[model samples]
Structure formats: C-alpha cells, structure tokens
Target: MSVSKQADIAPTLRPPPALPADGMVISANFSVGGFSKRWNHCHQLANFLARYASANEDDPERHATLLSTFFNELLEAIYRNHGATGEIKMRFRKKQNHILVEAEVPINEQSAKFYNHAVQLANQPDPMAWYREQLEHDVPDDDAQALGLLELAVVYGSKLSISEPTSGDWLLLAIQFPFTEVEEL
Candidate 1:
C-alpha cells in the first residue's frame, strides 16, 4: 500500500483593490538602456516603500501621502541619475505623479528586456483564461479585453492575451506601460 502525500499550493494573490468594471488602461513604450535600469531600480524602491507604508495602519491617508512623496523623490533621483538636465516632463493625476525621462545614450539591452518581458506576459494563463470565460458568457469582447489588459499591466507589467470563450478564438493582444503608482479612486 502506498500513501499519497498532500502538497499545499499557495493561494493566488489578487490585485490589491478589486479593479472596476470600466477602468481604463493606458500605456507608453520607450527605448532607453539606462532609463530601463533606473526604472527597474525605481520599481524595487517603490515596492519597498509600499511595504513600509502598510506596516502601520493608524492613519491611512498619512500613509498614502508619505508613499506619494517618496515615489516622487525616487523618480526624481532616477531621472537625474540618467542625465536629465532640463525641466522634467512630469504629470500629476488624481493620485499619482508620472515623470517621463529620456536618456542620451542608447540602451539596447534595457530596451530588449522590456520588450521581451512585455511579450512574455501577454501570453500568460490568468489573462487568457479569464478573458475567454468572460467572452463565452456574452460579455462585450472589447470591455473584457480592456479589463484583462489593465489587470495584466498591474499584476505583471506588460503584455496580455484574451480569447472569446464560445468559439475559443483569440480576440485581443495588449501591451501595457509600467506605471509608477496605483491607488484607489
């Protein structure tokens, strides 16, 4: 007689705050080696900041404000390090500030990494299966595609693929930009 051992599978982590039905996903693609390196570093920094902010829960608003400030400062540092001399093109939306930085030196490696990652994520299981299910259930293909793409961007930082359920036909191919920050609306 053989006994079967049970293995515990980790639960899939959902997006922090549930995404809205009509939420929109916006993306911008760039080609810069140094900028990509700095961007990846900034990404790690932002993750750390978020973890730190969540450590305490006395004042959620204060935590958000501090996190935003830290994000701005980190982006500035990354921009300056990449030789950005003039006024940086930074955009402030409702909850986040976005800075666009350009590099003087061409960064082929960074560009390739970003491009490849985007392509890989586009074909992942979660996005494809979820979208297919929605489409088969008669949800508007466009809406399902948009929502799936947005979720993929937030979760994996790049490409996503969706399919229609009934016909098992691929419907959407989406690539998303790496956003610096995301918060509840």
Candidate 2:
C-alpha cells in the first residue's frame, strides 16, 4: 500500500497561533496502492493549507495557486517514473517557521535513470530559469524530465533537498516553505 499525507490535521499536533494567514496544521500519511489511485492527495493537502496557512484575501488565492502547483508537480514527477512499487510515501509537515512537504518512492533501474537525469536538470544555478526553459521548449520526446521539481522551486519558493538513504533505493524528495517571521512588539 502507498502511504500518503492526509488533509485532516491530527489532534495531538499543535503549532502556535498563526497570524490568521497560516492554515491549520496536521500530519498524516496514506498508502499509494491501487485502492488509493483515485485519490488526489496532493489537492487535499494543498486545499487544507490554502484555508489554514495564515492567508489574507490576496494571499489565499496565491497560496492556493502555489499549493496546487506544489502538489500537482510533485505528483507528476512520481507518476512520470512509472514504477510498479505501490509503497510511495507523501507527507505534509509544519515546522516552527515553515511547511515541509515531501514524497518518497522506490526506484527501479528505469526510475533511477530518470531520477539522475531529472536531478541534474533541477540542480542548476537557477532552477526556475531552467524549469521555464524546459517548459517553454520541452518536446514530447524529451527524455529524463523533472518539470514538477522546477515548478515547485519557481512557484512555491520551496527548497529541494535529498536526505540520507532511508532504506534502499527509496528516494526522498522534500520541499520546505519558509514563513515570514514577524517580530512582536
């Protein structure tokens, strides 16, 4: 079964009162197996963030847009790999100052190749520029793509990082959204 982050904010977890802009905080995971294929986990998580992430009138819409991009693009990357393993794990976490979203999946030879290529493309000096260039010019035949990673960087201002191996060829991709810290009087 594929583990996925849920939209419901867990009861035990609590963060400081956000300035009406930060949305409710929660952490949950679901399986990504055949049964869960129809679910749009990303959108669920995104919408939750949209409603709760401290957002003003103007910011909510923008947050929704960015959150959508974040969820869609990350899922795109995972789907593009086309692996049979049904154990991918996706998470949405709120840190002291930022929201951390992540996805992890098992990698086969085909996915490993794609991962290497995509990582190389995404780790450029200016990832947004690279992503935009590819999006603007990417053809149907272009191999080894990571458009989702690019969109995450460009739209959400989330930094991408790979951590120590959790187990095997399981790849962990995480995006961190840092919130502005307002000093209190």
Report every candidate's CA lDDT. 0.36, 0.59
Instruction: Give the residue spans of candidate 1 off by over 4 A.
Output: 1-90, 95-109, 119-185
26-141: candidate 1 lDDT, tens digit per residue: 22223334444466466554445444433333344545454444444434333432222222222222222222212122113332333234335445556556555665787663
Please, what are the lDDT tens digits per residue for candidate 2 over residues 42-146? 566556654555343334565555555566666667766645665777666666656677667666667766666666665678876766666687444433266
Q: Give the TM-score of candidate 1.
A: 0.23
Cα deviation of 8 in candidate 1 (Å)? 60
Alpha carbon lDDT at 180, candidate 2: 41
Let me know the TM-score candidate 2 reaches against the reference structure.
0.62
Q: Residue 62 CA error for candidate 1 (Å)? A: 6.1
Question: Which one is best on TM-score?
Answer: 2
Clashes of each: 3, 15
List TM-scores for all candidates, in order: 0.23, 0.62
